[model samples]
Target: MPDIKKAGNIPTSMLAVASLLLSAPSFAEVYVAPFGGYSFGASEFNIKSSGVGNLASDEEGELKVSESAQYGVMLGFTTTDPGDIYLLYSHQSTELRTGNNFSPSPITDLDLDYLHLGGSLYFPKGDVKPYVTASVGLTSMRPSGEYANETRFSMGFGVGVAYQVAPSFSVFADARGYATFISSDSTLFCNGGDCLWSISSDIMWQGQVNLGLKLTF
Candidate 1:
């Protein structure tokens, strides 16, 4: 009779602990993310050393999203708390205008297919968790035509925050910029390997915007 109610509370606490232990495995999370946004950056077209005539000195172009932007979907699996890795399949395209120096002409468009392997680190905070992620993998670009088909290495890193809404779902936004380099031996349209008149450039860089949803198991 001294503490009948107090004795019952002890069993209640034990039951709560057992429930959490049972649910732990089911709480392991997996996320499939799809995102789309705009991309903007600059490119320099160098005149190949063996060119017949010099068109311009490393033509400066303005990056636009006319038909260009970084958008795609990715899948992720958590290997540990505050740590996870993702496989990303993304498409990025850009329109560059030869602003001045060069004569006005049709716009040159650049598009790329990226296959990325990367991981992220999450910082445990209050309601919002911030993370930094980096990826490195393969990328392909089809500048204007098929003859310029090129393959190269690509990589990117960014930091962003996500707010927890439900136990199984969270929304996130990130800003990332990436670059890749490919070598060209054919000057099909190029006066030389390093010439601007050449349909293709010796190097390329892209900046991307990422926004998407994350679902957790």
Candidate 2:
């Protein structure tokens, strides 16, 4: 029987991705890109809605993930058209902080990862190509301590350019953004017992910029 709990979630492991890439069609042109970059920006999750009550500040405020470094890889093949279809996996190590002040100390540490299957359409002008990319995926949000990990439906979009340095290789960079859907009832990041944050928004958003080398074979 299938686990409904994981219906839209990607496996948190790398093995499934490896197998998919390894089994690509022999005649297809495959693209493997590994990138490193920084991630920033996100709206607040209302703690009041969380029903967790105030921790320190007397004023009402929202909680959010701090800016941090992120890295990931994209593995997929070129389409028949002027586009590339690929699987993207990216990770960011960051912290969750509360209050409007957003102090240096965080409420808890968190690791954020994205697993997506998407495609990009390119505009080729000479060896330099500009493209727009989009992916529909899931996010793995793992917070330290008693908070059990949560997986939610998310999607990403980007615009970037790839300058072909060689016939089979290229260097590229993109500015991308992600949005994760949160249920309206205000339950997220739950342990079998307690849950943290109400996440009142229908969607939580984050943006990133990545640069990497792509090899096509």
- For candidate 1, give the lDDT: 0.62
lDDT of 2: 0.81
Q: List the residue pairs that clash in candidate 1.
A: 29-217, 47-194, 47-195, 48-194, 48-195, 190-198
lDDT, model 2, position 25: 64
For all predictions, the C-alpha RMSD in Å is 15.3, 5.0
Clashes of 1: 6
Could you give candidate 1's per-residue lDDT for residues 62-152 as a string of tens digits? Answer: 2222336678887766656676767778887664444444444544676767777778898968768899989987776557743355567
Structure candidate 2, residue pairs in collision: none
**Over 4 Å off in model 1, which ranges?**
1-28, 49-67, 183-203
Cα lDDT, model 2, residue 91 = 94
Tens-digit per-residue lDDT, 50-114, candidate 2? 44334433334577889999999988887666888788899999998877643436888999999
